[model samples]
Target chain A: MSTKDNPSESGRRNFFKLAAAGSLGALMASTPLKKVLAQVQDPEKPATNIADALKIPKTETSMPGKFPGKVVKVFDAQSVVEDKPVKTAAYQMLSDAMLQLTGAATLSEAWLMFVQPHEKIGLKLNPIGGKLLSSSHEVVQSVIEQLLEAGIPKENIVLWDRREFQLHEAGFTADAYPGIAITGTEKKDADGSYYNKEGKLYSEEMIDKDWFYFADVDGEYDDYTLPYMVNAGKYSYFTKILTQDLDKIINIPILKNAGSSITLCLKNLGYGVITNTGRLHAKLWGDTSAEVCCFPPVRDKVVLNVVDGLRGCYQGGPGANPQYICNYNTLLVGTDAVAVDRIGYDIVLKKRIEEGIQQEDSPRGRQFMEYAAQLGLGEADIEKIDLVEVIK
Target chain B: MKNTLILFLFLFAGNCFAQQPFVLRDDVLPDITSVNTRLFDKDGLWGYINGGADLYLEYGFEQVTVFDIKAGGIDYKADVYRMASPEAAFGIFSISRFKCQESARITPDDCLTPYQYIAAKGNFYFSISNSSGSPEAQVHLLAIAGNLLEQIENLSIEKPSLFNYEMLGPHLSGLKYISGQLGMQNGFVRWEPLFQQSKNYTAWIMPVKQDGSIFYVALVDFSDSADMETFMQKNGLTASNGLNQVVGNKIYTLFIKQNNRLVLTEGVIPESLRDYLEKF
Candidate 1:
């Protein structure tokens, strides 16, 4: 009953396409040819090893899962009280959004549509913003409660991110969620050291060597950055948690902006589950964000995207800048990562315009969403999306 | 005074070599809970900011010193970025400032929001933030900023002569300085497509609001004539056309090209700006 086993007929066709694409590509490794390849490449758009990730086929449980081109936004004025996210309000917001998204009569029914009692669920969080604008604990609690109501055991759930300490700094701890496994790809030892006795980063052990996203550009990290990036080279490996530890993924990204673009569903899951991402951001951010999810480990597992928009930054974001922080007091839920991101982008864009951050819409901001759509991930066109809004 | 200025320049240069500019002395603010500082060089910037470091690097970064201060029961984080030039520092500051509540009393190029204060002076961009935007926290934040600015004084940046006019004094807060695509995307997004074709340029934009209508005046300094020529060709601008005004559905644009610079106005252009457009 493993979710990975069964594939639809269309999935099989994609599998053959992937096998065909990887035949000659898998043989080409990091070599002197890389220098020659770099010379002819677009200096602006650097060549990435995205073909390597697409070698594996998408599965039945792939992105835009049960429902595609559908997004449900639940808003409540009382979601935050005295700057703190109210847990009860969050629970109700999520409950209503999921029911509307799935058209389910009960909360458990809506939860069961995306998960089962047997599957291991992973909640990927964005904690880069720290306490000011990180993914709220109230939303996470509401999600966990719904999963439990659907009969999934607490031990079957795990909380994870790229950095372990950052998750703790954002207030995700064992004491907070008892029996639930809390982990990250990059970890520090009990004595506050990034390296173990062997002088190798603990992050290196968490990566799956078999799975990697190969970009033509090389990343050179200094001693200070090495701990954060884990490795420096042409390869960015996928974390084992996505490859083996989790059977299903529920992406929980804070509703935030990265310049003109929104860092919603794909940006979180794309950048969160991979190592050596510090290099990809400069030239290949939009491409890596779309291509990384094409890999089977992520594409086939991410079933849901829950955006915590209760408190988010409208201007200087993807990182926390307190001046731009606003109380959105809304939760956006969708099975389609791209569609969810599109809606989230609109929300942030409207806020930015209202704040007079920018004069009008910037096409550059929507490039990532368009790229994600071109890759057949989900819907990016605003007109095609079926948005269901629930006001409480 | 000249000798003191020379000594200050020498100290500033020496400070770069020494790597520690000025440490926050505990004695200065006795009521402060704690002050922690960390330095990020070119190689280690990604460690602190992750992907957000790319835009800063694109604008030309040297290093940044971050300070974490807990005072008056509020947590504050301040970052002082040393950029390649005054323009680069101002470019970063212009894009980062949101709906500024009021101008900071320190420098003309400064914004003070409820939770953040951003300013640019010389080759340094300073950003200070607090978790709680209480009046007490803001007072402590300003004290810290004032102290930090006092340590490095008499450093100023050269600006375009157009900014010196008294007409723009009230609208100075709406000004934006941009150098690259990242800055364009963040600050002046409406002009992103027009600037996207050009390789190297610096632009300063000022927005004026009158009678509930907002319009913009922008001056772009192109690095080379070839880039300017290409820009003119792409946007249908020619010297022969003289004052070219294109009317769109929502806005009216006036394009004026001079040598390697372009002065443009959008929306309801003010008569003063239109009169000044002839001089360019």
Candidate 2:
């Protein structure tokens, strides 16, 4: 029945809808976008917090249900209209990629396979790479469109990242895309601190009190005293939204070469899901890239990972620089985060090796992948991964 | 592979490259003093390198003297990035080789863009981006590069003896010096996981083919023979003194410490490495 919800089959979709959406993007550029920010800011806005929501219990684990290390698909197209992500081309790439990854004959079937109609889905984006290299709005819109056609209400889907500033820098605000709840775990944008700019700690009520893990590494856990540590592994706390608000999380990470080696799904959700990530982060050298992503809270929540490799950077990144910016025009999709990252690491590693700067199997990122695989996170070896490619 | 034999002969020219240091003289570009220089220290490194500031910083970057040369009423931008040594200079230039297309017959050991010229000379890796893209600008770019290479010839770094350059079949043009974490992670050092960044070791990679780091012999120079041996002993990599210890997968990696230098060869037969080490 879910497979029968295709816009084409229902005749609900038309070309004019696309034209109107493009016009909306231009309009969003000029004005103070979505007015939903005020409503969602309340910790109790939805009335039912994560603790109560988990009791409504899901019978099934959602799409890509069991870490099916089956295959990672890559679809690339250089469709930049005046150096910007083109809507139609991006939509085509996403549709093709998702269908191939899930082996679904139709588009609507692919979406239903991921979530039930009433389930809340959170789309986590990586925006540290800034405007040009961050997650493309066009790509997000394509995903949103597919979700809408799948019978999921727009208000039920939330687009989130670690810091509000980075999300803003990535060019999406609550108002930017109306109906969708665009927000973050941190109250403000990254002010070089994990905590808010005002130095106030995030409310513990947002993190799942019982379902948390700690690396047990030596460091002062900042937000431990906030009465939220239902179990204080303190440093790494899963946000309440991750624990409660969304039933399925769609990891949308920017594909770029990182000083941390490669910032794909593993790094995006691993680091993005926790608090006091400062203890885990080390630029140029990977410190906690392994155990961070291996934690139960972050790993268990992610159902699908679609890497935004379209307009990405090759060298100086996860902090975007124009010089290293490349238009690979690719989208990599997979259920297994490590397998996807291992492939991403290889792609980025090949580029770095060509640049004569990096080598394969460096102790950091590559090792984290191996550790993830060992923990049954996903496939890390090239032999184990089945790669599907569609280039346009 | 014949490049190795040619490289063996080229190693002797290390002294030749270290001789000249002022190639950007008045003759290279008419009225060269009109070239204004902006000295960028660590704090202000971004003022010169921009996005690539941290790249140079990790390479023991000291300062960058960016010379904005005005000649024949054309603005030619030349940046002389000064690292700690010739190897650091070479390392900086090596990483910058990618993304540049349309190679000109300019610098023999450099990556040239359509409007830019890049090369390493002694302790300085320099680049010249010609805005005008005129015939006169091309001539000045070449002339300035040639003179600078000759001037800094004597300051060029010499290859460490551990590599046994004479036995090297032909892999010389693919060499660059580095000394930090970037070097260690890029096959310059064998796996230790806890590898520390240092200026004590001078690491350089010589890829086996066009673009690959997996199969290469990395020549690493330690402070002395004791230090080299101590590193081998401490890290349990001691496969020297008439013996060779091979490590790694995908590529057959061989690590041998002789004298003050450590030879890490990947993809080469361990049996042949003995004869190579004996030749040095």
Candidate 3:
């Protein structure tokens, strides 16, 4: 058969041509026409087929020089009452399994590595999803208790979200833990000043001056605007308080189906740093989303990524309507934000398939996962990932 | 022949429809309650008087009209002359800084600075002068009466102008008028005059405080839009969609109908007038 009719012969010729060239740089330069020829020849390793004799670089791990290992720990357990499988028992089992993965003898050792003893750890939770599809209270309180037991002072721990009123509506109270506190950026002190004003809580200030400084002087929203920054002058983007005191941040986000693809660690950080986050929604576009996500303030600041997947929201989430919540009984943790979100995209896809939903119909099912992967954020291929599961 | 006539008539009607109305209202001065009420309080120093003695006249001829004035409290002054023509009334006011000790002294160069020109005819005080360096100042103009020394304090400056007019009707209160210099970028003064209709012409006036100083006020009739547009263009103003609607092709004229009134007073231009002139 002619080489055109025999696909295997064409593949062999392309492979030898690439091999004889010795390097991808030489091959691409020598036979520019072979660029299209390389794509169809290797189906399994297409990204590698374009280049030859070059090994793909290993993914970067949290600890430098160490290969990235499985960061998630899952456990299997039976329910006490229903005599059926209980997810909460699985959570407790996974908590133990996490200690083994990290090579720590106890939970305290694991937490010590999770949060340093001297650090004032801010546990940023997502309550925007309301109670059902939010960061579980049990998981949050468990992490808070773990930090306290690991020698981080109770006063050094604060459970924070964007709005205090919403946190209260979602069932967190000031009086719940006296030493260990739960507060939002909007909390007021005894003197009635905002807790986060003038670089107090977060370092970066809100952009639009009219919302805070001008609105206060005009006495527009007298109750909310005046008492907070009444005498305080205008603050610029450089005047945020959280940047000063925070040495590290623990991002506890819920894995949810978002309108802008998977809302996980990246979206959680988007809401955390800026004051006028609604501006993001008003000017939404594909490049705008990536630009805002990769803005300097967010890209460098987030150090830990802990996604709560015990009860996932797999459809039309990041907004709490009753239809999206699913009991996946998984808790995922990784220092690589992109990796954690990559796994989140997979969970969303699997859940959609189980419900007989088309991938194209799901907003979170798009190729942004591969785009984010190509941007060096994480690995999209399941085969390249080392997933670890445990049972009790 | 009937069809041709109908077509000609139709074209003429369409041409007439394309012409827009002149003298459109632009931005309204914010209705600050206290300032508005004080401007109209007839029972107070700002009110109109029927007739009065040379009642507290410090200088000039006898027949004086008493009007109460208040900045924070009550004061009194006489109404000198209400101008018969709208074109001659004008006034200027501004807040700025004095750069040197010679800054307040009137020289040809003094007119180059916005602050010095305003100070030449009015009391200028350094609100934050270092004396060691150039200091910022806030200046106010007092209406000049015949006697330079007897002009009431800055508080009673508006008294003389307010009492001279009689109201024709309540709707006349909304007829807004302004006066300022025509061509000088750094040498313009602005004022709003109150007017009530009379039998022959629209009677309007601006107050002058003659406390040994001279200031300029001008009046222009806002009725002719073409005159206003010409004046704005000569003064280096270009047509703005906003000012074009407010003053373009509208017929207005200026006149001086008061005595001891500050000279160099030009017609009042709209605040939006600068935007039109600035394009040139």
Candidate 4:
């Protein structure tokens, strides 16, 4: 056993102290703690150092890319037929949406606008829902096919997420997309070990220590959470794949709800690119979703947002609950993440209202979008967005 | 006498540290392939469900044991959560279960959907799921849930005291128990603004229909008078001698606060519903 695998003596002492004070349960329970430990470094409420993220200079290709407030919504009833996605319909829908979005004469021209043959492109997908309600293979294949047709080499294109195993579980495999590199930050070896021979986490090396979202809020994780988080403290390091490997990122998130709010483009990119995200979700879910994108890695690299709504959950989601899953049969493409999410929120909210799940809109549901807009991420106000809808 | 006292203390401590049995034996369920159990406590819950842990933890989570089993040529994943209280267990169960296809034959409290079976019994809430949503898989899912339920000594599933009202019996399935903002957001979001103003309060909310109209009734119990007072003040309301009927923003609010408990009804209330609310 390596020393890195175990908590330091001081760390163990602090954990036990927190356990005795009932802070551990309170923190995990999301209960506001009144008692403050003078010696403890962790704050009662989550507070990330957004100042560091803001220091990075923004490029011309920074978020709200090419088309800022423009969102192209393409809905084909045949996109998902009887709970399954139609490959032909998916390809047609993507082609139509991209063409309309870029006003390109051809599909290749539209693809070329986002990426060049020389640049390494990354496809960030939401595969957390497994096979039941993940990003459909039809849509992913269509995106890859379009990229291939645009003269990008197969080796230059990568399909990735936070969890490698989940990406495989969702059927994003070597057999499926042979030449494209499929990878993740948190990966296990052939022997199913998340740790290397020296017992350091394989994910530990995958993180870039220099770049981190340093929050005043410290995370004290147990053994189980440590493997996923890689490290615990005030720092949440960005994955090397986002920081070092990829040049241009195309975010493909599933259209789903995380509570009242929709986890569309911003949520997927923000949470996916970093480590120690569990602490952020408790108090700063909206903040993390918005502020993490302000960093150069996410802000500058991510060029496009394509939401797979072909088969998504309208109610009980971000997780796949079969009953709540619906055939949205829709695809939303945009350069402005916030605009696409705003339009997606309206669609999901309308479904919730029509199903009698909710009577009226909750102000809290649109909070992340508002935060993202305020941070200069994109357009959050529906009135300001130029929505072009195509019904096929 | 001192030695005897020391021995008794050791026995009690040993019993306290004893593990909760989380396996389905061959005798209990025949033709089981294997059971792989994983335990999560406090912060460890983050690994189990990622961000979804917050909602469960907010409802006073203690610990959870997950069983990944291969049984009868079918893959089954079962999660058993031990919450702080029975109300906490039910609160999580209420928010998670949706559009139930039928009630599990094992217990009326269990909700059986096509791909999942969820139940809250005593201070424990558990869900068993299979990827295949076929009827064959559903049968095994219920059986696994039933066997797990039997192992739990406490089988009581108690509803809030307000449920004693006969008028709410028909809408029992729609009833939700909320503990915090996350629960408020997921279960009964319309009342999130009102609840956001206060803390240390648990609410039982339900929607009722009368004469082509829908209204919401929320029964809140605050941990202390200060919280209740703060909630009333923030929402701009005064505790009158009896039920105070306030009409604002095209919605009707009829509420009464006594000590730490408040029963409020909101939305477009008709004459008959108002009369019915007065009975409370």
Expressed as tens digits, the lDDT of each residue in A110-134 for candidate 3 is 7666567766667778877544456
In candidate 4, which residue ranges exceed 4 Å CA deviation?
A: A1-47, B1-20, B25-36, B69-75, B250-259, B268-280
Better by DockQ, candidate 4 or 1: 1
Q: TM-score of chain B, per candidate?
A: 0.85, 0.62, 0.18, 0.84
Candidate that would win on lDDT: 1
Indicate whether candidate 2 or candidate 3 has the larger TM-score.
Answer: 2
Residues B5-86, candidate 1: write the lDDT tens digits: 1111212321243333474555444356766677888888988888888889889888888888776667888888888888
Question: Model 1, B235: alpha-carbon shift in Å?
Answer: 2.7
True contacts kept of each: 0.83, 0.00, 0.00, 0.73
User: Over the stretch A35-133, how does candidate 4's per-residue lDDT look in tens digits?
Assistant: 212212235545555544443445688899999999999999888876789999999999999999999999999999989897879999999887888
* TM-scores, one per candidate: 0.89, 0.59, 0.41, 0.86
What is the lDDT for A66 in model 1? 83
Per-residue error (Å), model 1, residue B250: 7.2
Judge candidate 3 at residue A85 and give its lDDT: 28
| lDDT per residue as tens, model 4, B1-280 | 1111111111011113434444364543446667777778877887767877888889988788777777677677888888888788889888877778886556656799878999888777888888777788888888788777876665466776565566667878777899998898888777778788677889888888766877777788899988988887887767752344574574546456566887777776555545655555
Off by over 4 Å in 3: A1-69, A73-94, A187-241, A282-301, A359-368, B1-280
**What's the CA error at residue A3 for candidate 4, in Å?**
34
lDDT scores for all predictions? Answer: 0.80, 0.59, 0.38, 0.79
For candidate 4, the C-alpha RMSD (Å) to the true structure equals: 10.0
